[model samples]
Target: MNENQKLALVTGANKGIGRAAADQLAALGMTVLIGARDARRGEEAAAAVRAEGGDAYAIVLDVTDPATIEEAARWIEGSYGRLDVLINNAGITGSGRVSPAEAIDQIPSTVDLDMVRAVFETNVFGVIAVTNAMLPLLRRSPAPRIVNVSSGGGSLAIASDPDGPFTGLPTSAAYSPSKTALNALTVQYANELRKEGFLINAAAPGYVATDINNHSGFLTPAQGATVLVRLATLDADGPTAGFFSADGPVPW
Candidate 1:
């Protein structure tokens, strides 16, 4: 391992946008840790990146599982001694791949409380767990960055607008609101760590073709990953506590 090389960890990197972000970071010469709940899938994803001549490794990490999270942190601390970038990409939509008509499950008034809790567990609480666990290692680096993968669906400004593009999309209390909470959490974290030089921000990857949406989205995974990669690789003077997309700053 080159002492000067940076280490980046992308949670839930076995497939979709997470995998694409990992691949991009590896291509940029940063050693990327592919975090997946399934060990075999994680290894396969890492192998795919390694085949492309990038330094990548597989780490079994289920963000909702405290044991795996702690173990991952311990392994990273022992092996790399420090972490430069942390991308909280692991999340669940609660209801998988629902079409517009099927989005009734997420309707706020009749939504299941259990479903909402489960979504928050992974999308919100999970980020807090992983970020806090990795903070010690992140602090050891000269330039540390944290990118919380959010969604444009979480934008209240956009969602509330009757004329907005997302107005046609089905209302989602579970998935969309979870992301909004995640955005709030990101801002709080950024405020707490600003003086320490940590650039923590939220990234809203526009509707992309992935398992979460059953490949119904128009944008490719690589396209959705652009903002995540950009924010993760920001310079010291870059903005923090902001929500951004591939084009520019998104409404809060």
Candidate 2:
């Protein structure tokens, strides 16, 4: 890596919006690290980005595994010295999710506890592990940013009201609540680091058609990634401790 080049890492970058964010960040002249759980898929994605002339590489990073997160952080610090951006995009919607055409049976009343724990393991705790592991490297950068990829369904206000935009949405203690926790985590970190030239925020990618949703979404991965990429590369004057969607700020 060149001394003048910026470094960014996007978790779950082997596919979906994570891959799109990695590609977009690389296009903007950052040396993007694709953090994927599977080595083969990660390498393939990195190869694809290289074929497209982007400075991108894959690293095995399973967010749910603290060891992997720590190892990845150490690797980044050793390889590039600092991390300009960290996009926590690795997440799972839980095994209970199905197509929109079907009824969501995994409501809070009957949701499995193990499923919820599994969801939080990736969507919430995993983010905390990776962020904490990467903070040292992030602080080394002149300008650092953290973007937590959240979901619109995580909005408690929208989910609680019958007349709200997200009314009739599936009740998910596992997925939705995990994202809500992520949003809160974003604010807490922003408040702690904002004065130190770090900008931390949460971004909702709208309903992007990825494997998480079983392709029920209308937007493409690239389109969904725009807001996340935007947040990840925020200027000094950009807003922090906020939740945003492609359209605008999301109500918490």
TM-score winner: 1
Prediction 2 TM-score vs. true: 0.96
lDDT score at residue 99, model 1, on the 0-100 scale: 46
Give the TM-score of each candidate: 0.98, 0.96
Which candidate gets the maximum lDDT versus the true structure?
Answer: 1
Can you tell me which runs of candidate 1 are displaced by over 4 Å? 98-101
Please give the distance, in angstroms, between residue 57's alpha carbon in candidate 2 and its true position after superposition: 0.7
Per-residue error (Å), model 1, residue 106 = 0.3
| Residue lDDT tens for model 1, 35-75 | 99999999999999999999999999999999999999999
Model 2 misplaced stretches (Cα beyond 4 Å): 96-103
